[model samples]
Target: MEEDIQISFLNKLSCFFLIVLFLGCDTPGKILIKNETQDDVIYRYYKKETDENVAIDTVSIHVPALSEKYIILGFGSLWTESQLKSYIQNLQKIELIKATDTIVLKDKVEIYNYFKKRIKGVHKDEIEIIIK
Candidate 1:
């Protein structure tokens, strides 16, 4: 009986680890933004606010030069519109700023883009944005 219990415990532990490893591979829905510049760049991801109209939620994250940043959404493409978070289903935007200068540059930002027009009933698991 003792040996059987120990074996059962080991099997459960092994199954748990395998489940975690599989789930940790990547986000179901993710936006990959790449910074092709030679210097680091700061960017923002815009999501509409859920509770208030005309309100917004902005995520400011930076990527090392020649690297990429991933914006993981709460729900994946397989999720229906009703199942997705309100902010994520709305229009998604990204603002790219050139950060080579030292003066906390604000006005010199180069371009603005509409990352996703609108996440409709059907979407993709991955979207990639390349910024120059």
Candidate 2:
């Protein structure tokens, strides 16, 4: 009877471990680039590979006026904590290369509201930049 009880407990523990490993601790840090400008703004992100502010003229992430571009960084289970931290740190050194000037919004109450079912973030971690 004791052997059966131990086996059942072990099975339940294994199942719980699997669930936590796959679901609970696996979330990537996300960034949203909001273009509150008059015209369409074209911007790009780069990591400080060697601590040089090389002007990356490549026109990447495009956000229309009053729209947003969501970028996802760091893989959940694939990346270690240190690696994710390094990526975020490197982003800080990158310069904001924008085609147009930013127009600060007065009422940003719904700034973070997004349609999760329809919209998705670009999963290019190294190139994805910006937090606020």
lDDT of 2 by residue, 1-132 (tens): 999999999999999999997864566655557766666665554444453667533336777767778666545522333544444444422234455344221222221121122233343222233323
lDDT of 1 by residue, 21-94 (tens): 77765336766778898988877656655566577777788888999987776644433333333433543564
- Reference-based TM-score of each model: 0.49, 0.39
Error of 2 at 55 (Å): 10
Instruction: Show where candidate 1 strays beyond 4 Å.
Output: 1-27, 53-55, 78-93, 100-123
lDDT of 1 at 93: 60
Given candidate 2, what's the lDDT at residue 117? 22
The deviation in Å at residue 105 for candidate 2 is: 20
**lDDT scores for all predictions?**
0.59, 0.48
Q: Which is the leading candidate under lDDT?
A: 1
Off by over 4 Å in 2: 1-22, 50-59, 77-85, 88-132
